[model samples]
Target: MILTFFDQFAIPHLLGFPLIIPAMLIPLTFFPTTNRLAQNRLSTLISYTSKTITKQLMLPLSQKAHKWTNPLFSLMLMLTMLNLFGLLPYTFTPTTQLSINMALALPMWLMTVLTGLRTQTTTSLGHMLPEGTPTPLIPMLIVIETISLFIRPLALGVRLTANLTAGHLLIQLISTATLTLFPMSYTLTALLGTVLILLTLLEIAVAMIQAYVFVLLLSLYLQENI
Candidate 1:
């Protein structure tokens, strides 16, 4: 019975074709095309909003890191859309998959680290040990720092996956309870229904917040490198 609840997270297949592809594509439909000048308020708003966000995100980085603004902005938008899209009825969340999250996280994290190494090798390696550590603690500190460095990507992926999964599960459980009690007690059902609505709203906020947080952390990582 518990496993049944988790079944919702699994990728669906129809006639051996993965449904995730369509799910991923659905969010793109909401975006305004850049083929020409925006003729509507919606497109204009999207353009302005995107530019503002990109500028704000890049504000903390060095001039050299400005090259990453477009990619980071794109990542934030994609993740935000994917997360919000999942909240709709009968839609799937691609980011909820550990493999998907890791796939996104690992490369981005590695890029920042590699950029640091390539641009400032000594500084990057120096991060592994403090400037004035005692001789005995140097080896242990380097080992600990190395492990922590490697764990950053894993932490990013897991944080996103766990929060989304937990929120979805709670929504499912509450919805099931509300439906099951509908005939038994109208009052209780109404109360639970109200809670369910509020929870759904909160989950929506969580979805956006998590996406922002993911991009924000990546920006911080980039700042260290550049």
Candidate 2:
């Protein structure tokens, strides 16, 4: 009954209710709540892991950067949860969309750039041209650097989109092939099923890694500004 191959990527509606409501909310269900006196091992593990990652990210930043830890940690947790949840069968991944990725990237990138412009105005502008630049190349260098600066958010979004899209496409292709080949060749179908399972596991790792990479790059961007 699927109308198109890309239906899996489509924003789904069920019973005239936007499935996106649950698609988005499911990630929140896994988050560790604050009101509990004692948490399960899974929650404790998530807390410890998040704290460890936050510390590593903030290590190179200044003492004043502590203010950013909360937001960055929260964003990382949200992204990680969204990604891991997407691996579930019949689920949609919002981070797979360029618009969502860009939406997440743009504001943080802008805030960092703005912070640089505000607190470290001279230093921020100076990032455009390096020291000991030949006078002849100064104009060209500034133009190149400026372009690179604006491209940061675009890069962030494209990276996340391309990676997730490629993985999902491959998964679809392999799964379809396995199903199609099942009747004619049991051996081939079984082989492909194994491959599909392996790919799914790999995709899970990729989902986590991509989320971390997104936040890690953002933190690096903040490092330049902070």
Candidate 3:
């Protein structure tokens, strides 16, 4: 049997952020021109499985800003698939691993910085400081914004890693205890098992939300600097 290193609070790094490379590639697999077109078709099938709904039920386009959201949505979908895949019995959730999240977030943070710098505005860093402040206050706000900027990546890493880790561990503990302590009377254990399965689905949703949150904030920050 493959051993899990963490009962809880295990360092998430040794899991190898290798998860990122696969996450990045999942969307590319959907490109029809690629050799992975079969995977792409399968993804589309799963994504649009509510075939009972006709075109009449669909809503019209609201705004061009919608295009900006595609990359974020794609990332979310990929991570959600990864999360769901890990929900299989005896599997591990890479989304629960900190190293994977940090790997994802650090690139986003750097991209924000690079995009902001490339689109330099006359406003300068000075303008981002609060208005009508003393010279000392100026440095303070700059320092605060700078720190906040860095915190974006940290928050992204913590949010995904912690949520996934906690959810998986809770499910594991409940399932294990059920098997061990209530071996004979299995109804309650079965109910709890069902609840845990539902929670894994919820975790998949949460992973998508986190991806959108990361990209939306990063874009907003870049817009401001631009």
Predictions ranked by TM-score, top down?
Answer: 1, 2, 3
Poorest lDDT segment (10 consecutive residues) of candidate 1: 31-40
Error in Å for residue 80 of model 2: 1.2
Candidate 2 TM-score, true structure as reference: 0.92
Total clashes in model 1, counting residue pairs 3 or more apart in sequence or in different chains: 0
Judged by lDDT against the true structure, how good is candidate 2? 0.86
TM-score, prediction 3: 0.66
Q: Which pairs, if any, clash in model 3?
A: none
**Candidate 3 runs further than 4 Å off:** 1-71
Number of colliding residue pairs in model 2: 0
TM-score of each: 0.95, 0.92, 0.66
Please identify model 2 stretches exceeding 4 Å from their true place.
1-3, 15-17, 37-40
Q: Count backbone overlaps in model 3.
A: 0
Off by over 4 Å in 1: 35-39
lDDT of each: 0.91, 0.86, 0.60
Best by lDDT: 1
Give residue 95's error in model 1 in angstroms.
1.0
lDDT of each residue in 1-226, candidate 1, tens digit only: 7988998899989999999999989899875567655587777887788788788888888899899988998898898989989999988899899999999999999999999999999999999998999999998999999999999999999999999999999999999999999999999999999999999999999998898889889999998888
How many clashes does each candidate structure show, in the order listed? Answer: 0, 0, 0
RMSD of each: 1.4, 2.1, 6.5
Number of the predicted model whose TM-score against the real structure is largest: 1
- Writing each residue's lDDT as its tens digit, candidate 3 over 80-113 gives 6666656665444566777877887788677657
